[model samples]
Target: MMRCGSVIKVKPGMLDEYVKLHSSVWPDVLKMIKECNIKNYSIYYKDGYLFSYFEYVGIDYEGDMKRMADDPTTQKWWDVTKPCHIPLETRKKGEWWAEMEEVFHLD
Candidate 1:
């Protein structure tokens, strides 16, 4: 399994809405996530930033991500949630959340 972490800023006045939306993510979206081999996904908030973590168990991470992005339900979910995010200026091209480097890990 590969662990991933990412970060993005929540737009001002949008954190609550973002949290509420995530409180009950769409079933189809969740199913797609699982089908794409993403597990233990979690998002956390602190100050104005949102941190995300997940484990990828699939062999082809890029292909799985592409599959997830191509899903209609996931597209709709992104439509609803994208407005609440302020993507980091430092994020790579085509990245909505800035990928983080893992400096330490145990077990």
Candidate 2:
């Protein structure tokens, strides 16, 4: 399995709305995420930043991500959620959330 982490800035005054939206994520979107082999997904907020962590059990990460992106339900979900996030200025091109590097891990 592969572990992933990412970071994004929550728009000013939008943290509550963003948290509310995620409190009840769409069922189909959740299903798609599971189908893509993502597990133990979690999001955390601190100060103005949102951090995400998940494990990918699939053999093909890129392909699975593409599949998730192609899902209609996931796309619709993103339509609502994406606007709440502020993309990092240093994020690589084509990236919405800035991918984080894991410097150390235990267990």
Indicate which candidate wins on lDDT.
1
Q: Compared with the true structure, what per-residue lDDT tens digits does model 2 show for residues 1-107?
A: 89999999999999999999988999999999999999999999999999999999999999999999999889999999988999999999989989999999999
lDDT of 2 at 63: 98
The all-Cα superposition gives candidate 1 an RMSD in Å to the true structure of: 0.5
- For each predicted model, how many residue pairs clash, with residues at least 3 apart or on different chains? 0, 0
Assess every candidate by TM-score: 0.98, 0.98
Over 4 Å off, model 1: none
Residue 102: error of model 2 in Å? 0.5
Relative to the unseen true structure, what is the C-alpha lDDT of residue 86 in candidate 2, on a scale of 0 to 100?
A: 96
lDDT of 1 by residue, 42-105 (tens): 9999999999999999999999999999999999999999999999999999999999999999
Ten contiguous residues with the weakest lDDT in model 2: 68-77
**lDDT, candidate 2, at 20:** 94
